[model samples]
Target: MQTVKNFSDAELITAIKTGTNIDNAVGFIYRSYYRMLENFVLTNSGNEMDAEDIIQEVLVVFIDIVQTQRYRNEASVRSFLYTLTRNLWISELRKRNSDSKRNGFFEASREKEEEDVSDFLIYKEAQVLIVELFERMGEKCKQILTLFYYENLSMKEILKQTSYENEQVLRNRKYKCLKELTDIIQQSPTIINNVKSALQRSK
Candidate 1:
């Protein structure tokens, strides 16, 4: 895997188009966009499973275009991939809702406002770390933390959702889950500092 440096989008495209194979090309795309796509999916009403499936679909679509020599350099490859993934996710949500009897409606899309490239990079890295930390926790921890933090549901809401007997039990579980997440963040010094820098830079 070659490290993706400062290659202009045009140069990368040319290399990809002329190379004997697509391994490097695919890796470059993954390294550049995987975190952004994952964060977009997870933050936009997608679960980890949904995010994984969507990313795979995005890669498949990208590869198909590349193999068919159809990826024009009219726009940055990054923008093209992001738009493709976004459209695919929207299409998937419509399909899912159409197939199921669920009553909840999909919310409006949240487009990330453009920021300094460095800040965007760090913010994305932080999100990736948080997602990994959540995945590493126990199932109970994941559910509790996600309800309180990611879903922004109140204690009563969490209690009802989890079917807990009382508020006290819910509070205890929430505290424990949050503590575990904090510990995970504390352990990753590089990620913590990077995120801090990103936030500071944004301000």
Candidate 2:
């Protein structure tokens, strides 16, 4: 049998960001984090299968965050993965009316401080909606928005990278792309409410 090599936090982030060796990275994540999280869920009124589903969903969210360059490297990859998996499992337990006493015990035993789960869920929901809206946009709009917002490129830098002839043209296109995204977001009442709730929580 072959062994999968583990990646350092930096190495994992690079692999995910560049779309390089992602399979190896993902395999490493499963081999490393799955059992620990499975045990966690199983002890907290969930079965092995439920743990698997929760871990899978956490990986999806982790990959999306990495791809979007939203991960701040404030914590090690392992720590981040564990935190997300734990929170997700807790959310699931709450939904299923699991043993509250067991849930409280497990939650209290965790080493890290508890995150605001409601805020985390709201943010994730909004992120999904934003990603969907971005995908539905035209290629040009996607490129412009990605450059300006995600990549944090200046107007001049954007013009240099893109086919737009002038800064003014790029700026106008950016405005339209933003407006288009806003329109798409407005169509989703759930997203709007989540965004509002998140904002209120932040305030």
Give the winner by lDDT.
2
> Evaluated with TM-score, which candidate comes out highest?
2
Worst 10 residues of 1 by lDDT: 113-122
Expressed as tens digits, the lDDT of each residue in 1-203 for candidate 1 is 95555445776676555553355666777787888988877876777766665676566545434433446455577876676666656555654444342223234343342123223333433455456778978988888767654565655667788867986677666656655655565467675665566455555
Q: Which pairs of residues collide in candidate 2? A: none
- Which residue pairs come into collision in candidate 1? none
Tens-digit lDDT track of model 2 for 36-118: 87887888677776676667667766775565445767677877877787777665554445565445656465543234333
Give candidates' CA RMSD values in order.
17.1, 15.7
Cα TM-score per model: 0.44, 0.57
- The superposed Cα distance between candidate 2 and the true structure at residue 109, in angstroms, equals 7.3
Those runs of model 2 whose alpha carbons end farther than 4 Å from true positions after fitting are 1-3, 99-118, 126-203
The regions of model 1 sitting more than 4 angstroms off are 1-7, 19-21, 98-203
